[model samples]
Target: KSVGLNQVILRYASDKHERIYGMGEQYSSLEHKGKRIPIITAEQGIGRGKQPVTFAFNRVFMGSGGNWHTTYTAIPHYVTSAARSVFLTNYSYAEFDFTDDETISILSTTPTNTLCGQIIGARSIPETVAAYTEYSGRMEPLPEWAYANGVILGMTGGSAKVRKVASMLRDAGVPLAGLWLQDWGGIRNTSIGIERVWWNWELDESNYPDWHALREEAAMNGTRLLTYTNPFLMDARGPKGRLYREAKEAGYMVQTVAGGVYRLGHEPGVSFGLLDLTNPAAVRWIEDVLHDMLKNTGAVGWMADFGEYLPFDCVLHSGEAPIAVHNRYPEDWAALNRRAMIRAGLGSKNEGGNGEGMFYSRSASSQTPRHTPLMWLGDQLVSWDAHDGMKSAVLGMLQGGLSGLALSHSDIGGYTATPGRHRTRELLMRWMELSALSDVVFRTHQGNRPLHNAQPWDTPELLDHLRDFARLHRALAPYRAELMRESSLTGMPLTRPLFMHYPHDVVASRVATQFLVGRDILAAPVMDRKTSRVHVYLPPGDTWLDVWTTQQAPAQPTGPRHGHGVWLTVDAPMGWPAVFIR
Candidate 1:
């Protein structure tokens, strides 16, 4: 029913006992049985919900630290325990109200009367996922370098700093494939986290004077230079605003009601300028800019950063309703980058062919998988909090698996860093273990404030811990490659829930802390601080061997596949998170 000229509500019957999952990298939990989830894309606030950090940040920092319902990749899609899958077409602001056990409602603001969606039905969970992805979009096979690269580390500041870190890590025998420098253009430290970046996309000869030289040197050592990008461009209000000026003069930026350039505020230029993707000339201009920058700078990949901040009150060149086109903005951003990849000669040759070009996205919705080469669990707090930390990364990957984002991963040590919520020595150790076991693109972030966090180069012990886990990741590259290959063909996620493989086992449905890396391997990463052991549930009908110890499963483990399997307590030390292989 229509609430007003631009508001509507749609309700559906709900299953009281069926647990809900999948809404693009949500951190609260994997099962959203009785929670309200919003499908609006924006920064995943500092500490979600009414947590300690959130409560303080909201009052002090103007509520910038988002609540539990806030997320980066907010997709209006979900799958239930009963195998019911659904996807909504709205791109703008929307909310899924599951608080009511008997009835679920979808409330959205739209200029039109109708909304589009699909209710998928299949015989089994696997088939249901396959059909859902086939209808939405299948992910492209990851580039060969993704499997071979032991880890992709984020080293920021400038060329000099990057070289120093590289020399330290290489001397310590740590493996690295790509160095993602988010401040490639320059660094701009603001009062909060989001504005700690310079917006210009081109090479800032001042910030990176010898950028190409560093790229060449890295290439000689079998490494690649990567950078970051997003749809919005910040105006420094000075010569650093060259790109913004060009975009504005060409009438390529999103405008206001009076047809003036909107500088993310009331025209005083305190924020960034939103690039108008609806304009063909603007898209072409950005494409050329991306191609020239990468081709000239020798950057192989980039973190295609944000796409979730399209405000509904803006005027676009296409004249489409801004609210209606909000949710799909991130998908558009990914597709734009994919096209840029091809233009820059970094794209793969054939359908399943391998190439060095890769871009990892944290925000996604609608048809993003077809364009997003990789998915990284978005901004997680540096602490061990379940609402938004190491544990949330696991839930994000598993949720993406069921929702068709088949190749999701996360930052090894986490990104978001506040005063009290920064990274610690033990957190880094356990995080590396979890990352190595996943065997995807193992990577790390320097947090929002690099100097405050505990880094790998902090001590020799941390370096040795990094060296060991990176080697483990590299050693398992071949197996990870096989999983990626299977994902490309069948649309099954590399990070699967236990129930996807052991449907008959009742315990598999309830195991949320652990995840399956494809069908052959299982991992139960210790997500707690100062914790070493994890109680694992070995599903029935499989010969499970502890990956660390090579110990066989208990007797009668091959019992019927229908009941709750045996709960085994295994020793998981600092360097070893529980992992089992079939």
Candidate 2:
């Protein structure tokens, strides 16, 4: 059941009795009485921390990580068998080899511990994967308007500044869908709970004069308001401090052995206490607070940020093993938030609520697609490199089984450090073109820094491009919603890596620079700065039709030209990414 830190392989009696589940939608089941199947394993990347779990009979593979971050673990693909059931787990860094005779072998960068997975009987491989998807919980369909383009004005000046930008974006004819207010609601220029902390949760009247009015205006314009709330609760004076104390006393918060509550790195050394999601009372308390916000302010939802930093030195109320539970914390956190939304009748029935509930979270764990509807790639710089990085980030996330990604719009006009009005315009135009195709597109700039200010008026031309892209995004709302619903139902990724459709193609496995938006469109983003051209690989079977030019490329006959194949070529700049549909 447990492997060491280095590569090790063990053979056990092929279990004919155990039932299996959780390999996502690619494999067949063991109960199919007709045929015998081969299970093969392969090693792809090492140390990037992706571990895959496979069910041999169903051909379904689930991936997990060795560390604390969630969203890294995913169900990749699957295969099927009739006589016996098999599964593979590459925990840390490892290689899995499947023999023609159905023998499973594994090689690892470090020794890994694996679970003895169960075997199940199903009619077919796809059915097996579907069963797993159902058991893990299906993905939630995002709101129709979520697909439209919007701006995430970073935590800059104050409420006045945010409202001003919103007004201008609308006036400029930008078809904005939402406004993302980051960290502004938590503390108002200070860290959470450092001084007079309890009051921090309430509106900072000085900065947010007439906050209710602002929310009303935003909603009237078809824009939803999203704010950031981190897990860190600072130990401070007044009701804020008292809330933490009560939560802790009621066993609603996580406790550290060092006798100090957990704290996230923020200005003025702001510290935060962790809520123990395992405790039902804690869940209720958190729900009540959020309910109040929604009922009073008409706020839409929260950007549930930062559950990735749980300390190994802390304790959970459920008495679960910390190391085993660390990476699972995000799942618990998301579930708690989702539960709150449901209890307040603000979310979907699947999430145990009524309305269209959405939570944009940072970290995630297994079955995240079932709970958290949207996730932005974690913070990155606002520059060309950041722009290029978004493609890779998207590939990684999709390969890891995410439904959709919200790469911060900061890269469009460049982050705070790089300064040039013209350069900002070009970058924003290029970035917007690609962002328009994503599930949740929002523009944001880094705040608290001189160079990263993302005020829309900073560059007029960039503003024009922003408006154009926002409109394009709004037009794509129908398609985006459909995709979200499909991903939720099928466990298929919105942004797919080449390997998902072309698993048998060798070239496809290595093509990380490009990915598919859905089954039809393929995007190869320009990753290099100042470079106007790059190579693109197309999977073998289908001829590709360029999305922009409607040009088609003939497929080669050397291998499969259907299902999964690979082809490669170079493309020239077109002010946007090279998109092709077949």
Candidate 3:
């Protein structure tokens, strides 16, 4: 049988029964057992639940006494079955088939010799999946400093201005851990009258004078620098241009349907193409550039941006189909960076091992948890609405199996509207409290607006408060480091959703506005102005202890502690979010 979209063919010998299980939630057992289940190969947005496809074996159509079966459960190990199995070679696309009693053969419209005649055994499925995860690479632990309060200077100011701000933060007694330098560090220099040979990522020494000394000063003050780098290479420019040409020659860059290098639409100035990480040589070329940046600039890590621009019209170096590889590119991108770090001996598992590597990615895949240790919610509005949206984003990532997240700093003092010093202070304090528990706590504000500045010194009182909060973040680094280790080893999230704790609680599923920091601390950040109190859902069982006053609230089946259901009122004067521990 030939496989097409949302369909597959399975060939089986006569006289054999197949059983299968575990494709997400099942309405009925027969839905995914002993049948050939239809699978859709497509791209899904973040927070969207698993691929929109089902698998079961109970439903099967037989031809000439040959039976086909579908199973949701991928076997624990590779087992040679009497059934012949065929699937989309790409794992990101759904795989729906079962191995029982007969040899099952799967056919795809885009069949590759690599997948033809491959025999799978039932006993090795789980190990195979686990090995695949390991093969992709395990998640790396973030640096200790990443957990502390950080200042993300928008592109509004030049490098000198950023240095001055860093100096001011230090003078204010703020224990800053990192400085996020935006696009000012580099500019694309084009050869005169030549369209090709554009040089991006070249340091602007004139603007950033004494760059080495600046990095050293920050390092001495216990702060590191994180600069931004985009994957989009300028059309025919510099090393990237050369690399692109080389890759195209070697067939290592993705190609379009017309046999042209894929062009990224957002960056129209240059014809952009993605490097195929499946190609070892392509990975090596990218790694060399990363290593050179670290060795020369004293930079710590990268703020990997723009991975969301993966076009559906590109092909992989491994000859895999384009549609299935779009979302999976970020995983491969992060993996390439991690492997580079490991190759540099920075991530060697040695005593006092300096394995500090992470990426601020905008896209993800199923095995993203194994690559990106630190990911932030995608671009969001700078408004109170964003405050509520942040909760949903965090919970969504947690449920989707991400290990760590950075709630945008706009939740703090920065807003797109007119600035209110008092209100901004309140927001900043509350946001700081919540951010202190995150894997990365970096402050950022919107750009291009005079009134939307998030500089810590917006007010003398606010500056003092910011300093205090920054110090608290530094003090919590030891505890945060322990949690980071735990998150790396276990599949637990730093910020957890309610379902993680109360899987069966119907009420918890609807409550995405709040979450637990680790397993003990619960946080509810106010997302609206003039809202003094908010309702919190408590799962049945343990009583919770208030973080501020250490007051105990008795667990009840329903009703409010004061006036609302398990409500925690914010003391506006103190300006802190309601936090509790169970």
Candidate 4:
């Protein structure tokens, strides 16, 4: 063993017929056999948009060839078709080798002793997840309003603009539940134009002069508020920066091995200091900041962002090296927000408390689901390709559910569009149709550039579809809530892969384009643009009814109306997602 590092390789014999799943959020295929997965969280560019768009601060460059496997979240846990499961309990980067037919090996390097846990008698995926959650923790129930669709309005517009948008949604008769305000605090200019680099946890009164009034207006409209927050603090040398100075004096900021603050350079000329959450004083410092935001702003929650960049050579107040702290950083970030929310009298589901609180995050580890309830798929491009486009998001949702992210969503219509190019009406509608059927909250965001926004009311046709989906989401709230409760109690995801239920159906195991919401409803969203019909494989042993058309199709041993494992090419008209009930 090396001085600050211990490497362990665990191997097990496997059968040739075994199917494996998990390794957190993978876009390429749900089954993870014969693949090498690196457990690291970093932003690999948003694959390929129609035009060239670059965000250097995030390491996104102008390129057509994209890396779809680069992810913001990872869980080093898996369940095999052989009725066995494995979980790497340590928080460190590791390489998983599942390519060998006879042997599965996991090589991990960490500062702490390697500890892995295995589950026996895991006959199915759901059972494995339940056992894992018992060792970790289960999620809490989200507020009722979060089950509906939401729209992301970038923070550039002043408080008045938010009110105007809220009014627009109400006038348009759209059932809106949440409004996402990203970087409401402020922004700074970096080499890649302007980005949200300001670290002051307080809202920018200059842009939001009537911030309190805006919150009251949103509450009146029955909408919950979610703002953005990261775990970084800008240079403490700036005037009126009490947060930085206090953290520095209290020895709460992460330091390099040379005894300097561990800083990150987002661009050529901008840098920010990282918070050392391992320190008890530092945890209290960050919690106080969040508590003040909740008490003053009337905000219910935040979009916890950027927990993936802890330096491996840094030192912590707990004296643990970065290898032991890197992957666990996201869990710490989640804990910091959750504790602060609870301390401020905002908890999940009110549990005899005063208020309900929630936070949707992009980066998380194996235990994050136990702390935060909702998860949003990280940034995506506005493309239709199955690799990194809207369809890939469907695959992500399915994988995330099996891995225990019960409530998950993606940026509707994508979040990175080419500058000077507009997102087409058809593209947004297609994405909306898919988002409408998924188990996650349907939310839209203006990409990196403020001008290139995915506003649903762009066209009359688009607005009509958006309003319809919002209504549908609200109508299904009761059913969604039931599924959420089940998820919380059993640690199973609200959404499930088709094979999870029809395990014997060979075709269901290979179908990744469609998914089952809860237990009975099946959602098969049209993946390609301009496609009017989709092929669906109805699993055997049940009579399924089409939700769009109340026609009954029998699946084996019931009637000769439809054959077992019948593949139907159903018409999926524009603005409609192909759905069925079992």
Candidate 5:
């Protein structure tokens, strides 16, 4: 009866009226029924492009997953409008078929697998999330330190320039939480120019001569210090690159199936090695390295980068096959960092409950929220499009909320490389407006280019809007804390789709641009450039108030009792966002 060697297929029936939601982060409709969902993760670069060949090859290379919309994270979970939810526990290649309106079929790529799934019968979606969180772990609330605006400088800048930039932000009246020194890691050269390499985990002593003293000074200015960390190690020839040599000698690196250490070539560093965190000893080694870095630089936390690098043809120290552990790699990497932080006495609620310790990540899976506190929308292009711009971010957050990552954010001005030009002032301001009203933490990054950093100081026209929106974000603190508390106690996302609230409302079910922030406030950030007005749909059964103008919009004009909504075209200039409360 077996048709395939390592494939397991699942089939089930679904009511015609039931609608499905949840599949990690996808750019599809809010209602996921009648769709074929591939549960795989890959490095799907920035936005939609003409390079279909590249995307298609990566999709095949990655085994399974959506080619265009799916990115670094994938959670095999879904909730139905019938008050039923299903959580697939498998982490390997799998496909979900909801096309049969009457049936749901799933095919797992690995055989001899136990067909295990958690089905919950809840009264509502929120309740379903609560059950899911109880099964996985609940996400903790972010501390006040994380609420402020942040900036990441480019690689050309040294310690003094960084200090100057921090001062510039303060002088410009920008409320800054911290200055993220991304280039603090060792420097290198790629096709682009001098860049920071991922492999060398140590500070570049030449660039940051007084690293310890400068970090202490920056801390005094209320600007906390943060750095970046990834799993790649550059070649072993660099005089200061001891991590590579040591990891290989101790058998702490991932080995190719043929034997010997596995190496790969990439940008910034012509070639590099990978750290196999599946090896307990390797995890310990990384923890020690991070502890040393924290002690030396007085940094409060780090940016845990690049966990989506597990190869299908590689070896692991845990003795588990690569196919079995590939999809769960990000969650494991998060746990490794979490343990490292705890060992360094900088864990979340380690010393006191002030929420002092945290790390920002871009890669995740279903178990990621249990170990990580925050996840940012990965490197996005500097354009306004559905693929990787404001629209994608909005949908991504809503999807992430459904996936159980309540604490999320995006690069404020975008992070993709654009030749000869930085993000326009209009784009930056519009993005700032979006970040202001959303539940995601606010942060900025200089796109990947060497010297092309997007700084608010460069555009004097945006200073007022930037400062005002930051104040707006701070003003929403109390309400945001309430949302975080609910997320911590239960598993509801901070920002979820309108359909989650008005499931029966026909309009709300299809509106992905609008979302509810903690049940009362609705944020519809302008995703178009130079747009002055945005249409909003007010769900039936409640009178909605425009928070900006203090005016109420009447309920639905007509339709099935609870399935109706009123549409309102509201004014939304470049710097203003469309937000309402009910």
Candidate 6:
């Protein structure tokens, strides 16, 4: 019922002991049973309500550091312990209340009165997840090379720096899949980092005077080049900002309530306008721009980023209520990127692994999966803190899997940083251990401020550590390839919670922090600093083989076998994590 203008309240009966999970890409514990999750797409705040740090960051950055429920991708859907799921299709502002033990309440502010969805059921938890994904839609597989290669190293600045580092890594024998240059267009020294310019889309000739030649060289070295992009076109006025002026003159920009161009950003030259996707002309213009860029540069892919900043008060060219179109913006954005790739002859009709170029995004909702086959957990703080860092990426994959985001990864070693929160060599190595198992494409980021964080090439030990993991990841290519085939055909997530495999084992069903990679491997990455021992729960279905255990008592089967599951502690020193093959 409507409690006020454009608002409706919804409630559903729930089992008293139901353990609910899923709210796409959340940085929290796997269960949301007693939590309040706001279903809105935006920048994930710093700290994420984690403590004294959150307080300081909130006071300074005005809550941009984020809280537990703050997510780039939040869907109005969930799966419970009983193996049932449902998804709401509403795009308006909404929140999920699991505070009540026997009921789930959703309060959503929308332009309409109806809140609708479909209840999904199957024989088991995995089957139910499959059913839910089938009902929604399955994202296609990424190109085969994504799984076949080693790590995609993140770097910035200009072509000179990239070439220098790439040569160094090549000399170091680090297996290279791709190089992610987020500053291909140009760069700006911000309070955050040496981030690229917000307005420029064209390649900065000054930065990459040898662009075409570099692409050819990288390709010859078996490395694909990836760039970065977002939805906003910063409203700069001059010959340099031709696209912005042209878009405005063609009426492709979203408008203010008073009917002038709506601009956003806290600083000058940073403020920008969004392309009104509702306008077919605007959609065509941006897609064509993207298509031409990809083809001309011979770039295999790019990061299709930031679709969460659309304003609910802006006016679209199609005359639709902004509030009604808000949450669906990410879906539209992904679809547009997909169309652009397809237009450039980089799309596959059957399976997605046909060397079809791919893009990854950070925003999603109910329908965002089918279009955005690749999703990355948004920027994480450069700390080991679980609320918004390495540990949070674990939750991101577990929870994101339940929501049909089959291919997900995080910026290795984390991204965001403040004064005190910085990356350490220990943190970077430990974060890589966590990622080596869960992510589809092993990738790293230099963080918002590269000056504050440690990169893979920061130290000799870090470089050797990266090389070890890269070799291990490459060795798993055949296994991962099969996993991808399964994910593409069956909608079964590549990273999954334990309950899906050991449903009858009560203790195993609730285990967090550890997850399954496909149906055979169980990974337990250490989530804390200054720890060499990791406690792991071995599920009942199979007797596990330890991959790498050192300097500790052999793991013993302990506790009452809850369907034969038991606990074991093992040595997991730096660079070595607990991974079991079942």
Q: RMSD per prediction, one decimal?
A: 2.8, 9.6, 11.3, 3.5, 3.1, 2.8
Give candidate 4's whole-model lDDT.
Answer: 0.74
Rank by TM-score, highest first.
6, 1, 5, 4, 2, 3
Q: Residue 535 of model 6: what lDDT?
A: 91
- Alpha-carbon deviation at 16 in model 1, angstroms: 3.3
Task: State which candidate, 4 or 6, has the greater TM-score.
Answer: 6
User: What shift in Å separates residue 525 of candidate 3 from its native position after superposition?
Assistant: 1.3
Q: After superposition, how far is residue 576 of candidate 2 from its true place, in Å?
A: 3.2
lDDT winner, 1 or 6: 6
Q: Across residues 1-582, which tens digit of lDDT does each residue of candidate 6 receive? A: 555466777788999877788888877767788889888888888788778778987776676757788888888888877888877777887888999999988988767766677888666778877887876688776786776688898888788888988887888889889988887777778654445454557887788889888888888999999877777786655644788888889998899999878988754346688889899999999998898878777777789988988888899988888877888889899999988888777787653324558899899878777887588998888887778878888888788888788888889998887777778988899888888888888899998878888999977788888988877878888887788788877778888888877665667666778999999888998888899998988876467888764222233343335345668887888877899887
Shift of residue 529 alpha carbon in model 6, Å: 1.1
lDDT (C-alpha) at residue 547 in model 5: 80
| Displacement of the residue 13 alpha carbon in candidate 2, Å | 13
- Kindly provide the TM-score of model 5 when superposed on the true structure, using C-alpha atoms: 0.92
Question: TM-score for all predictions?
Answer: 0.93, 0.73, 0.69, 0.91, 0.92, 0.94
The 0-to-1 C-alpha lDDT of every candidate, in the order given, reads: 0.79, 0.51, 0.48, 0.74, 0.74, 0.81
Once fitted onto the true fold, the runs of candidate 6 whose alpha carbons sit more than 4 angstroms away are: 1-5, 191-194, 237-239, 349-354, 549-564
Writing each residue's lDDT as its tens digit, candidate 3 over 528-578 gives: 655667666666556888767888888755322322234445443334566
Number of the predicted model whose lDDT against the real structure is largest:
6
Question: Model 3: which ten-residue window has the lowest total lDDT?
Answer: 50-59
Which segments of candidate 4 are over 4 A away from where they belong?
A: 1-5, 48-68, 148-156, 188-190, 194-197, 236-242, 349-352, 419-422, 557-564
RMSD of 6: 2.8
Quick one: best TM-score, which candidate?
A: 6
